[model samples]
Target: MKLDRTDRDIVAALQGGLPLVAAPYAQVAAELGMDEAALIDRLKAMKARGIIRRIAAAPNHYRLGMVANGMTVWDVDDAQVAELGALVGALPFVTHCYERPRALPDWPYNLFAMVHGSNRDEVEEKRARIADLLGGACRAHDILYSTRILKKTGLRLRRKG
Candidate 1:
């Protein structure tokens, strides 16, 4: 959708995050010199046009007492990868699960699942549960533990004319 000046302003304002106030839209509206109702309408329009997916807080699992995190890579049957991926993603412990092209000459695993827990044993138990769920479909796998966190952030907005 073609965005107007107001839409552009709203997007730019929300790129960081909505204010932690009772009336965040009103705050944004005040900053942009637009009414709260108009701002809400513009945001709804943006959602309808698929410009914005959803607005939510990206939580830090490690900070929230989740100390163990493992990126589990699996070599599963290509035909059932999507179905199994959906199943794996549905698990509460599995935060992220997706299929990617395996890096040739080095990596042979195409399916990846991320499991989090308070300790290594807990994370391993989750991995074992996932193995049981996949049955014999998964050929080989590995759990890559995180050594350090780099960076994390939400969406970035492009300036519009």
Candidate 2:
């Protein structure tokens, strides 16, 4: 999408993140010399145009004391994966979930959900809940734990010269 000067300014201001405050958008609007509603309208329009997918919090699980993180992969029946994945993703302990194509031959897991807790035991308990949710639809499953943290960030725009 071709972002105008104001839209470019908005993306630049938010690339780092919205300010940590009660009214983050309002603060950003003030910084950009625009009102809150106008900034929000621009954001909504961008989203509709496929310029932005979403605005959401990307919290640090480690800082939040959710040190144990496991991505549980399930070899689920293809017919029921989408419905089951949605249930698994909605679990309170589940950080994220999605369906992926099975690699076949060497790999077969097609559904994945990231479960988090303070320890492995808690993560296992959450996994059990997901297993129950999947029931007979799950053929096999495995969990892969994170070994190290990676920095996560949103889009970064280079300044026009």
Candidate 3:
């Protein structure tokens, strides 16, 4: 979508993420020299127009004591993957889940689900549950544990020349 001057300003202000404060929106609105209601309305409109996909919290699981983070990969039946993946994604322990195209020969996993826990054992239990949920549909599966933290950020707008 074509962004207006104010819209670009809003995106630039929020690209780093909303402020970590009791009234984040209020602070952002104040910074943009606008009222809280107007800022919120603009955000809503932007979302409706698909300029902004979503606004969500990206918490640090390690700080929250969930040190064990695993990305479980599954090689599932092609016909059943979509249905089974939805079920896996709905699991309480699953933080996020999605399906990807399988790379033949070396990699065969089509479904990926991220599970986080305080330790590996807890994550294993969650994996077991997911395995049971997939049943015969899942031909094989594996998990890759995170070794380090990666910074996550949203889109950034460049300054006008």
The ten-residue window of minimal lDDT in model 3 covers 152-161
Candidate 2 matches the true fold with a TM-score of 0.95
Query: lDDT tens digits, residues 1-161, model 3?
Result: 69999999999999888899999999999999999999999999999999999888888899999999999999999999999999999998898999999889899999999999999999999999999999998899999999878876778889685
- Ordered from best to worst TM-score, the candidate numbers read 2, 3, 1
Residue 133 displacement (Å), model 2 = 0.7
lDDT of 2 by residue, 75-108 (tens): 9999999999998998888878999999988889
lDDT of 1 by residue, 7-30 (tens): 788889998888999999999999
Please report, in order, the local distance difference test score of every candidate based on alpha carbons: 0.87, 0.92, 0.93
For each candidate, what TM-score against the reference?
Answer: 0.80, 0.95, 0.88
Off by over 4 Å in 3: none
Instruction: Output the number of the lDDT-best candidate.
Output: 3
Please report the candidate that would top TM-score against the real structure. 2
Q: Model 1: which ten-residue window has the lowest total lDDT?
A: 147-156
Superior by lDDT: candidate 1 or candidate 2: 2
Over 4 Å off, model 2: none
By lDDT: ranked, best first: 3, 2, 1
Screening candidate 2 with a backbone cut-off below 3 angstroms (N, C-alpha, C), the clashing residue pairs are none
